[model samples]
Target: MLIALSFAVGGLLHHLGILRIDHLPPLHAHFRVPTFRLLPAAVFGLAAAWMLPGALARLRFGRAIALGYGTALAWTVLLAVSGDGLAAPFTHKEEYLAVLPAVGDDPSGWLAGFTEHLPGYPTHVRGHPPLPVLVVWALQALGLPGPLWAALLVVLVGCSAAVAITLTVRRLGGEDAARRALPYLALTPASVWIATSMDAFFAGVGAWGVALLVLGRKRWSRLLSGAGAGVLLGSLPYLSYGLVPYLLIPVVVAVMVRPSRLTVAAILAGAGSVTAAFAAGGFFWPDGVLATHAQWAADPGAARPYLYFLFANIAVLALVTGPAATAGLVGPIPARVRTVVAATLVAVAALDVSGVTRGEVERIWVPFAVWVSVAGGFAGGRAGGHAGDRRWLAAQVVTGLLLQGLVASPW
Candidate 1:
């Protein structure tokens, strides 16, 4: 039924003229190299064999990491190689790719004049904050090549997010929750874009920052976690204007779960550091963030009739989240985590409806999507309890990947 539902959704998207056919470019032709196509399958087969012992029984943290990133890399690389073979940008990667060479040439000038560089409303460069550019610039400085570096950075950040999600679940629930959640994080339909966007890195920083704050039950840990969360959360608005709303999630978690004066103080201080730095650099948060909307409002995609893609993206988000986990969101859970999760969902839903994210939310809503997957751990049924349940999730991911690969839509 879920498979059919996914196909139906894809069919509907095709009918709507959203998905189109494309001729394979010379660069993407290498994916047709028969040997290259076989490699990902071989890698996955070996990983499943290695992880079978741990996955079926204890699901240890180390094995979970292996399963998560191993699966993530296999799936992501397969998608990338299949689509473009790492030669051309994958869906919206141009946004991040545009800024790197400029940043590499003059980091200070870029920082000071980033807002001024926005040629118009919805300029690709204005689509995200400057942090990703700095990170990519540093990678380029270390001799990594163009666009490939962007891809690698995104994959690394995404895999780290998987680890952070595991840790957060371990803290809130237990090993069982963490174990059940890892696979979902690893192979969600979102993986198609995880290596293509700076949003994945933003999701990682935000996930770990909040995870540390909520999971740190010890005093010293709380101090460090709080401070780290503050810095990341503080940096969120700088990452993207859309992310400013997410600051509420960590703030609520800190206040509700582990309210300590020192933790709060550290958070404030960590936030202050970025604030001070950006201020020193002449980019005030309000002024910079407010300027993003001009491009957003001006972008043709955002200017389209909202209802056309609004419901479609919502449907895609649900499918990408997997049917079981989507079902689980409304099911039972521990009160504390449930509250956090529910609040996060409300924020995400509000954003979805506001037309700010008119379309492409499967990639755009990644930061909130991780939390939704985590919250699914608390749902009524035992996660992955049914026999062949993992197969079902795998099928969901595979189906989505095929749809994405076949479609000409840009992420």
Candidate 2:
């Protein structure tokens, strides 16, 4: 009973607090996150879900909460290695470069805030700031240390995703579908793109938030889940503006049409907090930020179109807001609501395909991709099939994870 209560309480706290912590830091802070990408964890996040649902499910409530928290922390460390510790893609480099000039002429000034800076650059942040920045910022009000912040990030950045993928796969596709889907993610180039780029974790937070909301069984659970999703989604643009289309577009459409109060509240709260944070950080809407980003991407390696990338994202928008999302719906939302989502998705797809999809920085589409991958798992589950095939598919995903873990960067 205690364990169940803790899960309920912790769920509420995690859901509510992520927004508070996620909002505290400056946008540029995330650009300097340390690289700690341990691709094995990404692989684990997908691969472990099959086992965990049972293991954690069977545990005492306290044990289950403890077990879940432990897993969350462990995963954060692995993903952290890939983010800020390494170099970033072209459009992404600018987020750091903008602030670089401001802090330039005196590298020590910036270093004062961080005792251990990334190697190579002179007073420069390697990639986007670690996902922990906002989490730490939330802790700052409580006087948490950097190392502790990093550890906390392991939970916020790591488990949010790991559990999300697990639940999404299980709920949508079932155990069989989840097992089948694991292998492909292990070797995808996009996964490589995601881990290496710093923005992936923030996007993961957003996705998990959505997943949590969907999985929540009670009204309070729904509220908390939505809150988590809101914080994660809102945090994305702060790390990389490129994620907006994927993160914001789908979320808006989903919320506009969804029947529940929790989902609506989560979106509103998270977005509102982020907006307040952005304004507080001085990145006013309709300001030089847009103009500056436009000019920066105009050069070589500019935001050119990637057919696969667009197709993948379009598929995600379709899956997330389309029939797949409908599958996640428990009670029926109004017909008008579903119609609006359908229309909005169509419009976004039109804009995305027409080469209007510019200013895309790094793998900004990752959050959406995460959504797509989960949606795929769901869609795969919904197909009229058998238990044997599902298990076979899951075995393949598990095998892929093992193989990818042995090789470089498991996406």
Candidate 3:
């Protein structure tokens, strides 16, 4: 559950980047087109999210690393075979545009650099991090062919992100909450687009960070969790700007609503680590901080559809999920929260359709989704709350899926 929350936050924070389907700038001037070698970089990230933690901390490092990488190798092999045969298509055309990349920009000779890999188009723009870049390279080493390699990486990452989300939901509210979100994350339009490529890796990392945040203030645990999350968070923007602030909003909001040493430390450590890494030029290469600012400075469309839709989506997801949730729980939450949340979502949809942010998808509304689930999780009452809760959750999930049907399908 903690992990799922992180993924949700990550998904939420970076929703902005998802809308920019038309043209995304290259990661930076120094970042050459990611060679096919980046394919492996994609899967290894998921491995870290899936495997690490208790075992790595307690068991032999070598064994843990080997086991994780070894399993990924197996999965890679499975996909390599299927991809060679054209396998399946699980994403939208807009996503294809992102993956296809513009023809000539791929001069890095990515195709030749990695063996079991895919040939990616030379991208003129920048988004996403090198976590994917390096993993892509590793996948190339696994004996996969070019064309299907990238797609394979995406599926693997999607699985990882899904896992993280599931765990986080379970952690926060319970199994019910996690189930409520599972279908949404896996089957949603935007999620499907992201699922077919290596985009899930970023979301997974963001989810882990959220898990740490929920762990709250426990000193050593807090420091380690926060530090690790920071490095990943800092590295994330490079991969995709949408991830940066998506998760941060709830974190910021929660912390502000009830400040705690743990929350504060988590925020500072994660953000600071990212800063330190960039300053040292480790996570970000060449231009470093200057390049980052330059890119942000150039972002004229920083706020599209504004913050309205995000709020709306969150409310919609919550209001319908579980009756217990609809009742607004015992805390400070009120019934009006749902009304306001729903209104915001409507406004966002109208804005997007009326020439604001086009191509709305699940990723764009992830934060809202997460909040709804969290609310659902908390909605379960003490003694006899199951009946109402189940009915409410069913209504929400069904309704949400139907709403998605109305929107452009990710398929």
Candidate 4:
């Protein structure tokens, strides 16, 4: 009942919020009711997620990770078939192509891969860092062809993140929490965007990196996990400028979960070393930050008013999280990590309202959204049972499918 009311109120607010704003973009061109064409694919996503729990329970961790990857890939392929045909050619392949030469031309792989190679990187690649671009180059170098490989690269990223989320939850909250959280993480309406966006790769690496840090003190290989985590935590700053904010997760997880002093120090050292490496490569973090604004100059979405989109983005986030998790946002949560998590969400909200990331925040905010979705699992504790219903979960799946099937925004 509370979930239903929250969705109703959210819908009402979106409608009322848009009415007060003038010069709003046309929704019709972007969003429409799909005909029968894509319905099967939409239905498939919901069904697969619903049925996954039993299958996941039977598999060990290794198989479970593979299943997560294959499921997401299949979901992406299904979504593509439903909308743009199975090939779903990468729309932003140009960005990958533009940065490929920098990787190929550089003699010292580490130095050139870390630096942005200014005056050479077409403006399209300027605002970005080199990690993902290098990954694209690596894929091509390995003989993977065209946009198809890039598409697979993104799928791998999202799948890896999904597996990372499962492992992290199991480490911190126990298997029950891990089990409860997987469905929300895998099939939440955001999977639609996960299917197409490179941000998923960023989200995957950053997420696993943090997961390693948090698990530093767990029974398994504390030295190895902490060491790797430190490197990941440090390299995050170089991945994407916007991703800098997400560094808070590792910081908060470290504090709340409490790793050993050595683990924490290693994390700091890893970041410092990576920073030094990037400096030697001739690209400084400050320059990357400045380049972001220049890159946004060509972004059409940036033109939208923040006030209107702030509310709209929240609506999209609510849908992305789905009805059950959306309801969880309002409910009570475990206190130990609540303050930090809430603060993170509040910070993201403040950033959105500031107009810095005015539009397409639903996509840009992927890393933060993954954390924010944790609220749903926490809410389940407050409810004395799980917070989400399978039916509501299915409803969430439909919301995402409709977004792609109806609006077909190629972001």
Candidate lDDT (C-alpha), each: 0.64, 0.41, 0.40, 0.63
For all predicted structures, in order, the TM-scores are: 0.82, 0.49, 0.47, 0.81
lDDT of 4: 0.63
lDDT of 2: 0.41
Per-residue alpha-carbon lDDT of candidate 3 for residues 49-141, written as tens digits (9 for 90 to 100) = 233332333444335334433433343333233222212332333233333332224424432222212223122123233335444445555
Local error of candidate 3 at residue 49 (angstroms)? 27
lDDT (Cα, 0-100) at 263 in candidate 3: 46
State residue 404's C-alpha deviation in candidate 1, in Å: 4.0
Collision count for each candidate, in order? 3, 30, 57, 0
Q: Write the per-residue lDDT of candidate 2 for residues 1-411, one digit (tens) a residue.
A: 332342243335335653222111110012132223445655665554445445553565445445554554443344434443332231243333334443444433443432234333221133333223334344444566333343344335533453455444444434544433332222122343343344455556655654654567777777776776677666665554444455544454454436386567776797689768656554444443344344445433233334533543443332222232323233232333333334434545654665534323224444444443332223333442334323433443333233223333211
How far in Å is the alpha carbon of 271 misplaced in model 1? 1.5
Question: Alpha-carbon error at 16 in model 3, in Å?
Answer: 27
Best by TM-score: 1
The TM-score measured for candidate 1 stands at 0.82
Which residue window of length 10 is worst by lDDT in model 1?
Answer: 22-31
Estimate the TM-score for candidate 4: 0.81
Ranking by TM-score: 1, 4, 2, 3
Residues 43-74 of candidate 4 have per-residue lDDT tens digits of 77767756766666567766765776677666
Range of the 10 consecutive residues with the lowest summed lDDT in candidate 3? 22-31
